[model samples]
Target: MSRRPFLTLPNSHFFLASRAAAVVTTLAAALVAVSVSAPALAQNTPASSAAAVTGGAATYDTAGASAVQPDDTNNFDARQKDLDRRSTDNNYRYAVAEHDCYSKFFVNHCLDSARNEMREKRAVIRKEQLALDDEQRAARAQKRDEQAALQRAQDAADAPQRAANDARNAQAYQDKQRQHALDQAQRTAEAPQRAANEQAYQQKQRQHALDQAQQGIGASQAAANQKAYDQKQANFQQQLDAARQQGAQKAQQRVENQQHFEQKQATAAQHKADVEARQKQAAEKAREKQQQQLQEQQQQQQQIEQQKQQGK
Candidate 1:
């Protein structure tokens, strides 16, 4: 007689208890996972991200639009990091599911279901990540526009001050030039007077010394005359020294004034250069951002085409 293979099952009580425990565990896990991911899922959806991309493209021709978008280098890096983290989490969950599903009586069905669920979850996370990236792009763009407006306002407010500074610098330069010319002319005109003053001083000293020598009427008288001549010489020397000091001081003042003017001019030039450099840097950054955005759009379009082909 041919006998059919008999199927053995667990005791009803044990089976029921095991099933209940699994159901409770699964429910708890589901609740925890839902709670953790709810906000992210709600905020970052494929539809929302697609909308942002469309909006961004629509405003591509707007002024300062490039300023709104940033280079994709950092953003792409962040996205990759997020993708890696999600992939790791998904892998861990898959491993756990594999272990649990294999121990079940319906191992094949359980494993298939678990794998499908993991794939769905992974896909959702990927879509959410993409959406988040788009949102960040939009936020960055908005922030850049705000900053540009603020900068424009600030520049407008500072226009008067900048103009005033420029005028003041110009006037100061003109005044320094005039003073320099005056000082040069004054020195030129004083040359003859300085020479005459020197000649007169020398002649007075010589005559006074001669008169003292000639008045040798008595020893005491001669001594008195010599003393008077010495006093006169001292006075003349003091006057000469004072005049020299005054001329030297005037020259030093002119030099100092010229240096001050030159320093001010240099500072103004450097400030103007700095402002120009900043403007140039801002322009370059904006151009780069726009290029990056265009490239990203192209890449996104290509990806969509590839996805379509795959679906087909």
Candidate 2:
């Protein structure tokens, strides 16, 4: 045991050296771990701070490469919208704003200028739409006018034809009436003349019979007076016969005269009827002309209204 004690001291020294080496290696490893963890902590601290500041929400960046504050971006968008609203409201306010310090003419000019500027802007847009509307309206108007013109032309053209046809019809009717009148007159004249001729012929026959009776009576008388009576009776019979014949001839002449008078009356009546018919036709034509003139006046009034509207 005394011998072992003498060598145990070196073993203890060697063991102490080994323990020290192990402690130095562990300390170096701990230092390396602390150095790596410090940079990682530093990186995490900034990210955490940024997350806290931004409320841990992702946002769109309109400004590239520029640090955009969430509040600033929201405020900027709100301000832009407010400015747009103000600009719109200002336009209306400007329209009503009074510039009493300036002369009336100047103030009016200023307001008018502003209004004109606004109007010009609106007019540019309206002009395009108005042009299209006007084109459509003009096309419709043109079509309507063309249709109206065509109708007028047709009416005008037809008017003469209708008048001509009416005239012809009126003339034809007058001619028919005149012919009827003439025929009636001729019938009336012929009836009287025929009756007179028949009466005359009957009278002549009666007279001839009376003359023969007288002659027979004379023959029956006594022989001494017979010759004288016969001569006297013969002379009387001849005279009576001649008178009857003369009367018959006169009757025939009167009948001819009556027929001629009736023919003249028929011709006069036909002529009068024709003249009346022509006068009626002329009146109708005048009426038609008046109607045409009235239509033209109406068309002229429409044209005047259209012109007034265009001026407006």
Worst 10 residues of 1 by lDDT: 59-68
Question: What are the per-residue Cα lDDT tens digits for candidate 2 across 1-312?
Answer: 011121222346676567456655655665555445533321221111111121232322221212335565434334333323333333333333322212233444554655555444332222222222333434555776688579668868987886786577557656755765785688688888977976886687568657767777454454535466568668867987997798688657756855665686577579758966885796687568657645654664465457558646
Per-residue CA lDDT of model 1 for 24-88, tens digit only, reads: 67756765675476445434433233432332322211112131235653464565455545554
- List candidate 1 stretches off by more than 4 Å: 1-96, 190-217, 308-312
Compared with the true structure, the alpha-carbon lDDT of candidate 2 equals: 0.50
Query: Which residue pairs in candidate 2 collide?
Result: none
Can you give the lDDT of residue 11 in candidate 2?
A: 42
- Stretches of candidate 2 exceeding 4 Å from the true structure: 1-124, 193-312
- Residue 242 in candidate 2 has what lDDT? 100
